[model samples]
Target: MPASADADLTTEFERLSLPLADPFTIARGTTETAENVLVQVSDGSHEGIGAAAPSTYYGETPATVEAVLPDLLEVVEEVGDPHVRQRIDRELRERVGANPAARAAVDTALADLAAKRLDVPLYRQWGLDPAAAPTSSFSIGLAEPDETRRWAERAVDEGYSILKVKLGAGRTAERLAAVREGAPEATVRVDANAAWTPAEAVAKTETLSGHGVEFVEQPVPADDIAGLRRVRDQGAVPVAADESVERATDVPSIADAVDIVVAKLQKCGSLRETRRVAEIAQARGCEAMIGCMVASNATIAASAHLAPLFDYADLDGSLLLDADPFEGVPMSDGEIDLAAVDRSGTGAVEVDE
Candidate 1:
């Protein structure tokens, strides 16, 4: 039996309304903070940590997560070994209902604990090479032209080579132009957050291509597969599906419509599921991108384990926060320094209060 097998375990969590460095605005709305819940799982000796950021867009909130956590804790308590992470993840999903963020917290915590028991980092435990991971892109949420320009400038000054600019605020052309003006040499990727019609997306893609944009993400609503295909087929830049592809099963259906599929831990429910989505993208001949909700260090660290499998990475969720309760993976010069991750488990440990 594994060392973690049959070990007694306990779970603990806390609600966090983490402030952002600036108000985060997108096609949906504007928010001043990221609402999250942090969870820890322990087996007397080894401790593992995870975090969940609930999005109302996904029908989840801090309250819903808090409401479902007790049942999730009960389910986790029944597990004999944290190493059976996928089995535990499935059980949690069955017990927790439509709470992917909650399930992500539990899954990450258990995966962390399992890696801790083996005294290795989660990526190494998964047999991933940190050096093989691509550099992550810093995000510039929708803002005034000057403000957007400043964000892009700062990102470039900090050595970020790629900029992920949020569009779809009715000034798509102005926003993209402003960002390009701010960091003229930086590679750019625009996310419309499903705000455009197929025709609008196609037109904007041509305009944006001239500004040096590398790609466009979720140009239409999630359910509009035909619209997505229209944009992908007609646009100059490649189209990446974000809201359209949530599960591995959703991959095949949209594979022909997108050049890339964006996978997020909260949306996929577990690292295993996220990997499955990446594999599906690969099998379908589409590039894979790893994305994240506004999250804490624990979540970033956990997601970084799978960074090697992606063609693009937008995992700067923790960097957007006003304060991070933990630190694991180090982001420097536009890349997540996977070499800096030498600690055990998911390598996320809370800062001193």
Candidate 2:
């Protein structure tokens, strides 16, 4: 109940309501702002920082994460070394219950602090080869057919070779065709965000095949496993599960139904758990796609540490923000340049005030 005299550390957090470049719409709803909380763990000189951005779909809000993090900070301050991440993480997961976003913030901050103490980047600390990091896909949110084409072209102009287009809006086929027309050479993945019925998903997947779409994500509702299986069986394009696989246990239940399993740090809580979920997906013969909620660079940088473990990377959460107060991983030409981030921890640093 009391920290030892040898354990002297400081922990702090702040709320952030970051604005998006545009109103981001999905099958669920639209968001013009990202509600997040930033966490920092320090032992005198060395410090590590991370952020938690809650997603409404995950049943978390900024208020909930903020309320839970204070108690979490108290528990983590007693930790002598943040490198024993599993022990702290397991305790937090147990204490925090279903609050994955809060757990992610603390887990990443401790990890960052530990890596910084060792003077090595998080990738190296985790024994992950930096070169193995995958290229990330730029997201094009839902819009009219012409606007969709414009967004696709904008992403291409910004040196993004892969585009993840948001579907489920009207004119799905035409919009996808427009996306292809805009960035004909770029890899295209579509996310319906669980907007369609099994039959509609099958038909849309068939139509999207003509547009050179690579995969369709969460085509059916999260609860509709049979529907998902029907889409996977009857559809031509590969299917990825987003809303369905929040936890590792959710993976096996839908592994046989989908071709890909999407994992997010916010939903998985800890980086360790997110990695485990990805591993589970790969072991089940499903492609592992590391995804992100609309968050700041701190969150994205934390997720980038595990980028090598995934088949696909969607670490563009910070890119959607209108302004970022921190610098984490660097993205150049749609790829995470790990060399630039080879300094310490997650390589996330606050902008000089």
Candidate 3:
């Protein structure tokens, strides 16, 4: 084992249930309960914590994520060296197959423990600063036009400058118009969650363009590469890919179609993998946006560490929760206080005992 490896460190996993104020609906599925997996690593002194949420987009349910906990813990216990850890991380993902969300939970915990061991924050490991946290957009799930508009207004009033509206149940135009009317000065973006056909996507983009919408996310299905390219070519607004760009392997194939790539730790399977996706997206001339599933402060705090490396962000998952477990990353008028976690590791304050 390498000198930096902590062979004595112990790992444990837990499941938590958090509630969402309203049902969160996207193309993949609906979420009313925030199903989270937390990883704790102890060296008999300081402890490091990391989190993840099971996402339906990746075929993950709470039960599935929970069921895989024992295997993930075994991998953590067996791996020690950082390089070996990284390789083990990859192998574990393959071993577990398509459970990216579960893989992410373990990977993030390992990274957090490594950083904490060195007394360095996770962002610094990725060449980011804790004092300068990233800004992120809050999401507005599918709702009636009036309700959506009111929600947008409330978000703006609460100091959120960017708003991501969930569309794709056939009211794209109405919703966009309502948002525009309610928060004219805010940066508004729409995500269709792959709910539209190519033709409908183009038509909806045309209708939404006049509202000064920032961009449209995954307007077409993830499998339709040609459709995404067509939407990009015809639409005045930029097209971003959420569901389409899942892994580093998928980056090259869809590079031309997407203007932005949303990187979620759950989708990419780890902080290392998520960083690789960001680098790949940037190299391919596509902007990167770090996002999260409906998660709590622990995962959101982890995502915030990577926010500065991206051009756009949608990481305010904690804000959507009815109650968050930990003290959340501080935000002031739409910007994260990067200085909060200037220490090593995730900078997560201890959840109340």
Candidate 4:
């Protein structure tokens, strides 16, 4: 019998400092370590795991995630049923309201618990098609032109057919030239992380089009709806909204302005809301990308299960790590292999020392 049939849930969390393989820099800044809080839920037998990779860029830090987790866990305990996910989602929102990352940890953990109780993977629980999941893109952080060239070449040599290169702080032309010189055949995408003005974004997009880039993400400031509209209308390449589209509600306002909406569980607060954002984006005729923070496999696996519902994926957070304490779904040549995941739940197994 499944544990959800007679649920007795216990919740706990721990902070982990996951080191990066290289100093990961974006348009905003650089990060040598990713601070994630791992949350686990148990039903006396199997354990379900998830994590919160807090980003100061989104007004969350390790301290903030840790501070709010007790209340979030209290809600999980009070509910006492891992299967009652919608109720937990509602109450967690009513309770914490601000800490999206903290709530996401609990939500993902509970989802994993519920799915494991039934001995099914999360994508199976959601009734999603594994065949539909798009190939994920490996990200290359900002660096000098020579360094960018080397990493791009290395990623291609490592069998990543797709590469997401971070670009900003000027020298855009030289950096992109470096990438093209490195991996001319690899599918390339760029994310500026909201570092440009509308005019600057347009010019950059023109340059991106020249490079045969797939798309440019968050080119202008997040709040600049008018700027986004201008870029989408005037830019040479398609634009995707990552920083601007914070949740499902933000979808309607920006859907018409951009070609794609980027959804991240860390930003949305729950697995359910992430789906909502994708559904709403599709309904609005905008493509959706399942993106992630530089996080552990505990949470990346959770996001990977949702790839079947998206047009693109950027769940390469764990690949950026020096070492992850957990292992999740398998990826080969950037293909997310949810079908290859034999373990139930999110497939987030802890790595043994």
User: Number of the top candidate by TM-score?
Assistant: 4
Estimate, for each residue in 19-92, the C-alpha lDDT of model 1 and write its tens digit: 99998888998888888898888889988888888888788998898888878877778875788876787788
- Report the number of the highest-lDDT candidate: 4
Model 4 RMSD in Å is: 2.9
**For every candidate, C-alpha RMSD to the true structure in Å:** 3.1, 2.3, 3.4, 2.9
- Model 4 lDDT tens row, 153-246: 9999999989999998599999999999999999999999999999999988888999999899999999999999999999998999999987
lDDT of 2: 0.87
Candidate 1 minimal-lDDT segment of 10 residues: 1-10
lDDT, candidate 3, equals 0.79
Assess the local accuracy of residue 338 in candidate 4 as a C-alpha lDDT between 0 and 100: 94
The better candidate by lDDT, 3 or 4, is 4
What do the candidate models score in CA lDDT, each in turn? 0.87, 0.87, 0.79, 0.91
Worst 10 residues of 2 by lDDT: 1-10
Runs in model 1 deviating more than 4 A are 1-7
Kindly list the per-residue Cα lDDT of model 2 for residues 1-353, writing each as its tens digit: 12222456788888888899999888788889988899988889898888998877888888998888877887787666787888888788777789899899988889888888889898888799878889999998888889999998989999999999998746888898889889989899999998898988998987888888899999988999999999999998989998998899999999999999999999999998899899999999999999999988888998887999999999888999998888889898779888778569888887887
